[model samples]
Target: MSGPNGSETMPLFEAVHDQIASDEDVAALDDWLRDNPDGQRQYLEFVDMQHEIERQIAGVFSRGPDSRTENATSKAAADGFLFPIHSVRWKVFAIAASLLAAVGIGWWGNSRLDDKPIAAIDLDASPVSRVLGIVTASENGLAYSGRRKLESGSALRSGRVDLQSGSMKIRMESGVELFLAGPSQIEMNDPLQVQLVSGTVTAEVPDSVIGFAVKVPGLNVVDLGTSFGVSLPANGQAKVHVFDGVVDAEVERSQQRVRLKDRQTVLFDGTSVAESSYDQDLFVQPGMNRDAIPTTTGDVRFLHTPPTSVRVGQFEHDLVLCFKERTESTLLETDLPVSLDAPGHYRVKPRWQNFGAVPRGTLVDSYFIHLDAIGPEKRTREGSITFNRPILGVVFSSSLLKGQNEIFGDPRTAYVTDRTNPKSDPTLENETITLSADRRTIRFSWRIRSRSDQVRVFVAADR
Candidate 1:
C-alpha cells in the first residue's frame, strides 16, 4: 500500500474515508492529486476499488441495517499484504501483514446508500396576473380570478393591493383597502422579499374551500383551516402579522415551522421566524349592520361600522363566504369556531402509518380546503385555524357568516357526508365534538384499532 514517491497509499484511503464521512465535496481530491502523477494513478486505483467495495456494502446495508462499509475496507486492507510484490518497502509489507493478522477476520459490511423519496409540497394558490410595476405612496388594484405570479420589485402601498395572488400587506391598504377570499395563491418571489409591502386585506375563508397558499420567499403560509390576513412592509422585505386563526410559517431552507395565533405576527428574512411578544395596535373594524364585540384578548376588538361589501378574488376551490363588517368602529376582528382543527392529520399521513413504520389503520375522516381572493380590487386575507388535538377531519354544515348572529353552529344532532373527497367515511369512531359561543375551541375523540399515543394536528390560514 506504499507508493513509489515514498508517500503511503494506505494513508490516502484514510483521508478519502474521512472526507466522505464528513460529507465534504469530492472535488477536493483533484486538488490533492495535482502535484504527484504517480500518486494520482494510485488514488484512481484506490477509488475504483473503494467504489466496488461501497457498492457491495450498500447492498448488504440495504438488506441488513446493522451492516457497515468500514468492515469491508478493513478486510480489503488485510488481504492486500498477501501480494508483497506490490509493496514499496519492507515496512509497508510489515504494516499490511499486521492489519491482516488481526482477529475478527470476517469483513464488515458497507453503509446504506438508499435515499428516501420525498413528496412535493403542494402549493395550491394561483399566480398573480397583471402586477403593479411599483407600488408607492397609496395605490390600490384588484385580482379578479386565476393565478398571479409576482416579480421581486413589486411594491405595495398602505391602501394599495393586488388581491388574487399579489405581494405586500395582508391587512387593509394604508387608507385604501382590498380583500381576497375564495381560493388563491399569493407569493413574494423576491430574493430579498422585503419592502414597505404593507396593507390591509380582509379574507373570508370557509372550510368548504381549498387551495390557498401564500409565500413571502422564506415563509410558506397555508390556509383551508380558517381565515386570516398577513401584513408586510411595502418593501418585499418585512415582518408578518396574523389577524386571525393560526398561520404556520415554514422556513424552506431549514424546514423549521412555527405557528402564529390571532393578532400575532412574526418576522422572517430567510433564516428564522421571530414572534412579536409586544401588543401591536389593532387595525380594521366591523360594519354597523353587525354587532361587533371584540374579544377580551388585548387590543384586538370588533365594532360594526357602516355596511360596506368588500370584494374578494376567486380560485379553483372557491366556497361561499361572509366578511366581518365594522359596525361601531371598534377594533377589527374575525370569528373562529371553538372546535376548528388544523389540516395536518389529513394532508400528509404520518410516516409511521405508511406501512414502512407502522401497520395500516382505517381513516376515520379526512378533507382538504382551498381559499383565494375574488379580485384584484379586494383586500387580502391570509392565515389559518388549528385545533388543540386532531379530529375526524371537519365536515362543514354550512358556509361562514359575516356577523355573530349569522354564525353557523351544529348544536343539534346532524350528519353531513363529505362531498370534497369520496374516500372519507365518517362514523362515531371518529366523532367530532365542537364548542361554540365565541372563543376558538377544538376537540376530537377516536378509538384506536391498536395501541397508539399522541397525534399531531396543524392549522394554516391567511387574509
Candidate 2:
C-alpha cells in the first residue's frame, strides 16, 4: 500500500486500472517502476487480470445466463477474483507466475532472432600504409616543424619533415637510406615515394628498391637502383645528380621524361630543363668532415699553419692537398706545431710518390692553398711562397672551376688559369698560368697588393 519513499502508491494502481493516466503521472510511474522492479511485474499482472475480468463480465452479459447455475458460477468466478486481489500473499504469488511466463516468452523470441544469419564484415580493410623506416642519425640543433621532433631511432610515417637546421639520416624498410641536409622539407608519401619541397638530399637506393622515387617542385626523379642526390634551391630550380646506376626523370607540367645514366645530371626549372655530365666532387658525402683532409698513401706527411698573428709584418697560410684514386679521393692539410719563437720561414716537402698502382684513367692530383694576412694594420704586406707541385686550375670560388672560363691551357692539358691581373681588383680574375713539361714546382709572390690580404690558390694536375 506504501511506496519505497513511504508514499502511498494506491493512486498509481487506481490510475492503471482505469487505463487513463496523465502524461506526468505515467512518467512518475516509469521512474517508480525502475526503482521497484517487483512493483512493475505486479502492475503488469494487475492490468492483465483487469482485462480478463472485463472479458468475463462481457461474456456473461452477452450470453444472458440461461440458467441459475450458470449465473451462480459466473458470480462465484467474479467474487473469487476479488478475494485474490484482497489477499496480499495470493496477489504476490499470481504476479510472480505471470512475470515468469512473460520472461520465458521474451527469451524464446530473442532465440528465434538469433538463429537468423548475418552478413560478414571485414575489419582489416583500413587504408593506412605500414611504417617505412626510422631516423637513424640526427645532427645537433636539428629542428623540425609541422610534425614531431626527429630523434635517433624515431619511427617514420607518412608525413612532412621540415628541418630548420642540421641534418638527418633515414634508414628505410626497403633497404634504401637517405641523408637529408638541413633547411629542407620532405614528405614521406610511402615506402616508395618522397616529395622534396626544398633543400637537398642524397639517396642510396639498393637493388631491392629500384622504383624509389623523389618528387620535386616541377620534376620527379625515379631511381633505377642507384645512389643519387637531388637539390632544390630557393630559386625553384631542381637539380638531380646520379652517382651510379640510372634514373628516369620526368617534368610534371610538360610530361617530358629522360633517362639519366651513371655520372649524369639534369636541371629542371619551371620553364626549361637541361642535362649534363655529373660532377662527383660537387657535394660532400653524408659523414664527411670538410675541415679534415684524407691521406691516400702511408708515408704522407701532415702540415699545419701557425695561427694568424695580429702583430705587424706577420702572415699565415693553410695548405690543403687532395689526391684522387678511382672514384674516391683523399685530402691532406698542414699540421704544423705552434711555437712563438719559431721562424716564419719553413719548407714543405710533398714529394710526388705513387703509393699504389694507379687505375687506367688519367689520375689527377689537386691542391688548394688558402693564405690569410693577419697584422696590426689593414694594409697588405708583400710575401712570397713557392710550391713544387704543378699549378693547374685557379679560381676564387670552386664553382668557377667548372669550366666557366679558359685561362691558359690548350685542349691537351689541365693547366688552366685566370689571366686577369691579381691586383687592380681583388675579385676572381680570368688569368692563365703557363705550364712546362718539367714545371713540377711553382712560386706565388705578392707585393703589397690591395685586398690581397686573403688569397686562395687552386692547383690541379693530370698524369
Candidate 3:
C-alpha cells in the first residue's frame, strides 16, 4: 500500500518495511527522515500506537495463572513495525519449522540502532525498559504503576509500582528473587537495588549477586549473600528481618552501618536505626495464599524442556508436576514414612541417604512430586520445587513412598506403588534429589519405565 506523495508510500520507506532496503536506500531514508520533521512526527505516532499494542498484549499474558484459562486473542501482526521479541515457543521439530520461524530481534529497540534514539517507547511495566526484574509468580495479583497493571512475566523497570492487592514474586535480572505483598509500592533504583516506598518484600539473594539492595525511607539494606525481608507499613517505620545469611544495613540519617546475621532484625525511622526483635509473622509464608504452596504450574528448569500437563498415558512431552498432598497437618505424634528436611545435597540413593526426623511437637505439611510414565516416554525426566516455608525432609524410597499412601499421600490420588518396598535401583532410575543449600528449593531427576516415579517433601507448617 502506498501513502501520500512523500510519506510511508515513499520507495525508501517501502524498501525498509519490506526488509529489502539496500545500504543506499537505508541511508537515503535516514537522511529523508532527518529532514522531514512532519514525516518523523507521523511515524512516531504509529510507534506509540504499536507501543500501546505491545502493552495490551502483555496484559493478555500477565494475568498470572488465570491467563491459561483465558482464551488468547489473535496474536498481533508482526508486520515490519518494530516488534519486540520476548522469545517465541517452537513446538516439535520438522521440515516446516524454518518457514514458521519468523523470529524478529528486539523490534522495539530498532530506533536506537545508533547512539541517537529516534523516539523512546515509554510504557509502565513494558519489557522494553531497562530490565530490572520479571514477575515470575503471583497469587490473586494486582499491581499498578500509574494506570498500567502488571501481571506475571511483566518486566519491572526503573519506575515505581503499587501492588494494590494480592501477592507477587519478582526475579531481578541480577538473580535476586523477591516476594512482594500487596498495598505496597516499590521503586527499582537499578539492576542491583530497589527502594521500598510501601509494603513488605522479601528477597532471596544468591552469592553470585551479592550486594543486591532494598532501600526504605531512611535505610539501605544490602544483601551480603542472604535472604531478607523489608517492610514499611502504612505510616509506620521500615523494618528489616534477615532470615538467613548476612546483610549490611545502613541508616541514612545517622550514618550508621551495621551487619546483621540470621534471625536478627533492624528498625529504621528516617532518623535513627536500632536492632529489634524478629517478628516471624510480618511477611508472607506457606499456607497463606489460596493454595498453601501457591506455586507456579511452570517449574523453573535448568536442563531440558519444562514439563507440560498431561494424563497417565499421554506422555507426549516431558512433565513437571507438583501436587499438594497432606496440607497443614500438625503431625505431632505421627511419624512420616519417608522424608528428609536437612539442608544439603542427597541423591535418591537407597539405604545410604539420611532423612530428618521431626520433633514430636512440630507441625508439618507434605507435597508429592509425581512423574507418571508408560510406553516409550517413560525414561528420564527432571524438575524442581521451592517451598514457601522450610522443608523438614524428602522421602522417595518405594517402601517409604507407599507406606504413607494412607497418611500423607492423597487418598484420592491413584498412586502406583509396589506392595513390597523396592530398594533404590540406580540402574533402573538414576534419580537425584537435591535441596538448595538454603533448603528453600528441591531439584530432582527421576526415571520411570513403568507406572510412576514419586518423591515426597515435608515442609514446616505456618502454625
Task: State in Å the error of residue 258, model 3.
Answer: 1.3
Q: Model 1: how far is 422 from its true place, Å?
A: 51
What TM-score, to 2 decimals, does candidate 3 have?
A: 0.39
- Over the stretch 175-240, how does candidate 3's per-residue lDDT look in tens digits? 567788887888764556777888899998755454577887667898887899999987668889
Which candidate order results from sorting by TM-score in descending order?
Answer: 3, 2, 1
The superposed Cα distance between candidate 2 and the true structure at residue 380, in angstroms, equals 72
Assess every candidate by TM-score.
0.25, 0.35, 0.39
In model 1, what lDDT does residue 395 have? 31
Q: What is the C-alpha lDDT of each candidate?
A: 0.31, 0.47, 0.58
In candidate 2, stretches whose alpha carbon ends up further than 4 angstroms from where it belongs are: 1-129, 145-147, 276-282, 288-463
- Give the per-residue Cα lDDT of candidate 3 at 67: 35
lDDT assessment of candidate 3:
0.58
**Which has the greatest TM-score?**
3
lDDT preference between candidates 1 and 3, better one: 3
